[model samples]
Target: MNTVPWLTILLIVPAAGAVVVAALPRRHATLAKQLTLAITLAVLVLAVLATFAYDPDKAGFQFGQSYDWISTFGISYSVGADGISLVLMLLAALLVPVVVLSSWDEVDGGGAGGGRIPAPTATPDATGGTPGGSAGGPGPAGDVGEIGAAGEIGGVGGVGGIGGVGGGSGGTAVALAAPAPAPARPATVPPVETRGEAETHGRRSVPAFFALLLALEAGMIGVFAATDVFLFYVFFEAMLIPMYFLIGSYGPVTEQAQRSYAAVKFLVYSLLGGLLMLAAVIGLYVVSADNLGHGTFDFATLRQMEITPGVQKLLFLGFFVAFAIKAPLFPFHTWLPDAGAQSPTGGAVLLVGVLDKVGTFGLIRYCIPLFPDAADYFAPMVLGLAVVGIFYGALLAIGQRDMKRLVAYTSLAHFGFIALGLFAFTSQAGTGAVLYMVNHGLSTGLLFLVVGFLVTRRGTRDVGAYGGLAKVTPVLAGVFLIAGLSSLALPGTNSFVSEFLVLVGTFTANKPLAIVATCGIVLAAVYVLYLYQRTMTGPVVHEENRVLHDLGLREKIVVAPMVALIVALGVYPKPLLDIIRPTVTATYADIGKSDPAPTHPAAAHPGAAHPGAAHPGAAHPGATHPVATQPGGHS
Candidate 1:
């Protein structure tokens, strides 16, 4: 029964719910919330069951389902999950429901920080005397003062299930990296704000946007599950529409500078990457036809086709570029922080939690398997870049004033770790990278949701403005502590287990890189502790902060599950590792057999002319060369 094409149902039900949600009467807020929550919850339940039912020992796609879609091109409405896709899909299904619930009170405008799109022009009855209505700007003078107060009476709400997990050392290190906030310079909003019109159109076109979100999900799921290259391209290209609306229309504080800039930047980068990938995909299909006697976009077929080393190197660039931008790796990563900081909390959650994983996923699924030699060839450069991202993102995060943007840069660091684990060429690293993707989604998504609440109440994203908040909102403080700690890879938390695996695996392959990566763990503590200290510690200085409140039932319920998983996965990672290990082992075996050993300078010098040329048998003119074998080893 579990094998009955569950992926299709997982993709379709939310889509159907979007339709149901739009048709309901505008006044029926309760029904809308209930309907959306129920649909997302159902998806979660199914996805969970699918995860359990999945056979990790299996070497190929399972719960496989296919139906002809574009017969002429051999495209099919097909879906399946291997260990990699299983974890990612589970990540998506788990978070969407939580995000929905977190927004229940806000969208309904019935609880703390209540605000929704097409914000009521006049103060509504449900706002409970909160001033400034629902544009979600600062409320009365009291609300403004509360923003400045830190250690006042417990006015903020508790984060129920998501708080109280351990691993504080790891998480704290990341948070304490800096004390000051980035200077706030006013943004230049074009007088016309053409983006504003698009947003208005999107709000009026809620049904359309919702449909697009579902469609995006469908494409993302397909991209992960696809066994065929052309099918992957089709789904990959389809993702842009929903994301465009999610950024352009449903963004938080749509009138702000970040929103418009993020939306446009995201579109340009994603589209450019897609076009380059499209050319590569077409080229691969043509090559397969000529070489293998069939024009096929199937992943299995392409993997078996033996293209020249030159072809692999060139083609790898096209695919790698696309995936890196999606992964938003270091240099290509400029657009992500902006999109994450300004977009709706839900959009940000999905973008970081689920979508970003696609890039790394592509690395494992397509890059390594199809271009093994190229991947081996490029390993050093990739590892170097990953290291840079880890440090650069942490430094940037430490300097952030906006809490949302802070969360965004931290994710960049996290992605760097995941990428390092992946290209490090150890099975342990690969499994860790896969599991990290799941843990990141759960933890980061929760962080964004919680921060959204903060923004909702305070009308600002500035960290310095908040002082000793633990006294006012111990529950929120606890929630932030857990989420921040998890981000920092605290022990007894899910992130710790995966991060440990990555470090352990990376160290096994490259000790110096591992040592450098460990510095990121320290940086993690610095930024995370700073975030916690600035927001939740100290005395409540502002007079207005004296009356602020803490977490209510709705917020508690939404946060609890995510926090629970952080603990569960942290303590009992064996279950997840057990599943991921087998698949990773199989993939690495395939890749390793085809590619030569990656040669770092240390391996190449054996007491050579310089430390950079540490290995004796370096190959290729590219900077630290990769060698097929040790100079002393038998052929």
Candidate 2:
């Protein structure tokens, strides 16, 4: 048994770092950010070290530590990492630093209006009528007065301004209609602009943002490292708080109400799922009490108990529903689009990349092993949902106008592929599903980061706003194209390998379903390539796009590692496969299933004797009959 409490240390470092960073003086925003980055890097180094120390040949969970807590209710503070948990921990660690570096200038308060654009001056009509209205008529309905220099809107028809109508005759000058002075930028609140567009954005609290980010990291790590079921649930629900604030406080939308609405919606959906899981957890304890003579929340111990089929089904739905919502599978997925579109770039990366994986991970970790019979019982329904999601999400992705929403939709489809593989119940499919989780994080995380870079430069997420960006920002375009290609599972990119494995494995188990799921690949191609063509090719129709600069040094640093990993994994996935396959095999074994033997026909060798027939002069009393030789030595 390993003596070091590696998982506990991993959890504490980030939790403690968040507290420290949050306590820093407001003026030390830079220091807070730097410290946060250093802490994330440290976590990454530790994760790497833990990876090295792991023994894949071992039979069960490694680096495990357990201590009693809440003994009356059979709860404990236990932590450990299997292969699946370890890789995910590494992914979260790797992406946090990248997010921080990419968002370095995202919240620096400086420049005109603290990086926000001054309100545009209204243009007068040809007849010199009131600005933004017909001559001698009321200004366009619902038009507010110009924003003042201090970022406040001037009141209409007040002491300092005229009414909706300019009170001027045709071809006459309106003396009272002077434009409002520009707003003064606040020193402490920096605008939430991307790196290059720091000159024109609104201010958000930097220290608060980083602090929330660190807190989120702690929660994510905890969820994966946790060994106690109740503890897992605790970490699962607790992570939502930081993400709620991150989305509500730092979203790119200038309107606070919109951000708040998205945040609320996300919280509501997650909380509902959490409630279901909580009930199931209580149900599980009751069942354990009856079966084991006492209620306990230990995951391994619970896995050893055999519950009746009916109770297993009921408990399964509770946990499965929660994970599905987290997975945001099909109908449960409505909140993700809004959340992803509204969140800031870094927030979006973690939201979709690492956070959503918790759902699928739960399905593998808690749902299947603990309720094997129920998992099998619900397999058909889940498979149907997975196939539907593949088509539905892909079609919507193709139709989306907003860049971030489009990416969000694509994840919905990718999760479908993951779900399909997991339920297929073969080691190959299960391994592919876990690998897909890691690869999706890298590919889609990179996509969100690059899109964020574009949004920073252009200050918009509309797909229509860009045309021939490659003309000016070739490097950015290149990265975007790579990310897009990987998303579509282009043959040479990382997603392709995992996606291919998923299909092949699914094919072995359910040929018809696998065939139908394959069409999602075509739809994926349409959305990914069309998005690239529309945004990066053609004439530079908008002049604003002409002057956009390519990726700067910091931005290049952000993308290079991701791009390298995508290509490297695409070409050779053996290392990850080696780490992932054993756990996948064991996971499937837990449910009493194994890989199905292939049914393809094999050619008979010329002049070979039929095996069941006794060989000439070789048959004798009590002699064993020789078996027919086939490919792989299977009869």
TM-scores for the candidates: 0.79, 0.84
**Candidate 2 overall Cα lDDT vs. reference?**
0.78
TM-score of 1: 0.79
Tens digits of per-residue lDDT, candidate 1, 1-635, equal 65577777777787677667767665565677676767777877988888888876566777777777776666666667787888887777777777666655543233333322232222212212222212222111121111211211111112211111111212111111222222121133223121112112111233443444455566666677776677787778777777877786566533445667889999999999998898888888878878977677767667777988999988999999999999979989999988997677767888998889889999998888889899999989999999999999999999998788899999889999999989988766777889899999888888887777676555456787677778988898899899988999888899987888788678768889999989988998998888888888999875545555677777788789899999898887877776776667667776653123445545454555532342535221111222222111000
Best by lDDT: 2
Model 1 lDDT on a 0 to 1 scale:
0.69
Q: What digit string (tens of lDDT, one per residue) describes model 2 on residues 153-224?
A: 222333344433333233222334553332222233323332123322223457888888899999999999
True-structure Cα RMSD, model 1: 13.1
RMSD of each: 13.1, 9.9
Off by over 4 Å in 2: 109-202, 601-635
